[model samples]
Target: MAKIEDQRIVIDCTCEVQLQQTIIDAVYLALKLEKEICFFGNYLNTSEKEHLQQRTAFYANFVKKDIPSLPVSVLLLEGKLNKLVKELGEKYNTILYCYSGAMDNRLLEAFYRSGFPFYFSKKQVSNSNQFSKILIPVDFRNSSKDSALWGSYLGRFCNAEIKLLVANEKNTEDQDLVASNTESISRLFNQFSFPWSSVLGNSSSWGIHKEAVKNEEPFDLIIFAGSLNVTLVDKITGTFEKRLVNLSEKSVLLINPQRELYLICS
Candidate 1:
């Protein structure tokens, strides 16, 4: 775990219609967690790079107007986009990216492979960017812990309630693992005195997201753990990670399973 002050959120600034909403969401989170914001722009040529410098500055000022106390910076990243994103991921704990339907899958995949947690949304920022209810779909994987940790952080900062949607596993081994994972997450929440509740899904792990989206409770945020192993079917259709992001209208916080995530110190 790292001090909360050490956390920084990198916001990918683009010339998309949803850019304003993305900045609003990033600034809201930064204010809530007392973290700094770095507006990042990726460029291909010197001309574009120079233009991005000004663009990032404008966005920075946009955030500053709403959040005067928050610290902000701008970075013009040149060279490969994915490589630069990976490097940025190594430095920042979280990245905020908006899906604009144009090359969104590629942009999201880059973040996914970057091995960092990311907040993705196609719609506008949540009302006042207040996530009072968070949903975390749990399964029999170590990665579930990462998502749970994020859920606890949001729960603490936003004064939100956490709901763990546990997977219904038929296999004996998987059932034991799911139970173990669920208990561990519950203990983590209890340790922080964060309010949490759980419900068993009627479907297996594969169908968990469908169940989550259909949940009666209106969650402001959904924290999902990225799949470590992408199956062949995922290649043809799409990874469950992308599917969840696309399917859910609510904001999603994705935790990459392959990386060791940083936690906010209490």
Candidate 2:
């Protein structure tokens, strides 16, 4: 999307869905975006022995159902495509999501090596750019503020309503702090002429995160930002981010310089 304008680009990434279907849906989203769109689909190349025929059949079905919509220069390639991506430049770019269920950092390194700038979930990059409504979970910490800034930016762009969520233990003191922060954010939004808004919940760290992601509402988008769980411990450290990546049915952005999980959206 380098040469493309900002509003003309959208991105969708998924680990589920038939590989070819994912590509087709991406094409649909891109076209609907009325801008350039690129969808990244990754298959475990090493697993070919188990499902090569099945995989091929899936792709065949996709072509049968949808490939006529390929809009000219949309380049689709597989294998260790890092080099091919470099040659193609940035007009269109993608890297493999193959991890062998190991969550290897090597894939992240490979993505950068391939020259793809930013990545996005299928929901975030969809044509629904305006926020008719949004749910943002925040703690009192500065980390939550990181998410706030991004959400505020989006709200300003879309003029959409907002909901700031927090989890509580019913303590009066914590409640007061939550009140102050909520007021501050609301005032900021009004100052910028953002739309209507409100806040809920308590200030626990994981509380805000889990509640926000697990919220049963069907808001247009939910954001958890700055750094979610970036502790030194092994499992739960990156695990929080991983859960959001794999488990989320919504678009989740897990950004942190330490984890090198920044999202590149043009």
Candidate 3:
């Protein structure tokens, strides 16, 4: 089994229809990764804290009923959402956030600035307890390695099959870099004895994610290495990470390329 430094998965609880499914998805991942679970919510006042606690308790109990052996904690945090998230990121390597079908700019910003990888999901759990197939879109950037590392971890620990979507760049230098990345990623997967396949994408680096999300092949999750720098256009519209997280129907595992990530050890 692969071991992580923290070995804890934090689930951000909300009062949305996606709440129950989020818990289920988190439990599934926690069990697979052999990590403890924490259900977290933010509250402003005493009344709100009580209400959030009740909501978290109800769902935590539901999860406990089925998986009695799992270690679970429920916490009501008091602070700005971004500050709270940054604090949590310091203690935990992974955080799970479920979208309520509506875009929450504050929540997205919190996750973006936290400098940690986050699992973003919707109302429905696509793979349920088994994340059998994972799609990773790879480009020439060094950050692509982080996403590949995550894929290898899941592939080794959760028995997931990795599918790499390679970006097709027109520039010779970029294309050469892309080839090198593909070779390196393939080598990593081979070293771990995990099953992975690669397919060339017919889009630019920024647009390959769209192709991956819209691909005909069924995938349980899409792992993306996001850029930290935001341009003026990105602000007016949204960053590529935000757009991918919002538009993807399948769950997305978003990794901050700028952060030094902790790898799973054998």
Top model by lDDT, which number?
3
RMSD of each: 2.6, 7.4, 2.7
Tens digits of per-residue lDDT, candidate 1, 108-128, equal 567656656777754643466
TM-score of each: 0.89, 0.52, 0.89
Ranking by TM-score: 3, 1, 2
Worst ten in a row by lDDT for model 1: 94-103
Error of 1 at 77 (Å): 0.5
Lowest-lDDT window of 10 residues in candidate 2?
94-103
Candidate 3 at 38: error in angstroms?
Answer: 0.6
Q: lDDT of each structure?
A: 0.74, 0.46, 0.75
Segments of candidate 2 deviating more than 4 angstroms = 1-35, 39-131, 157-159, 167-184, 192-194, 226-229, 232-238, 257-266
Q: Give the clashing pairs for model 3.
A: none
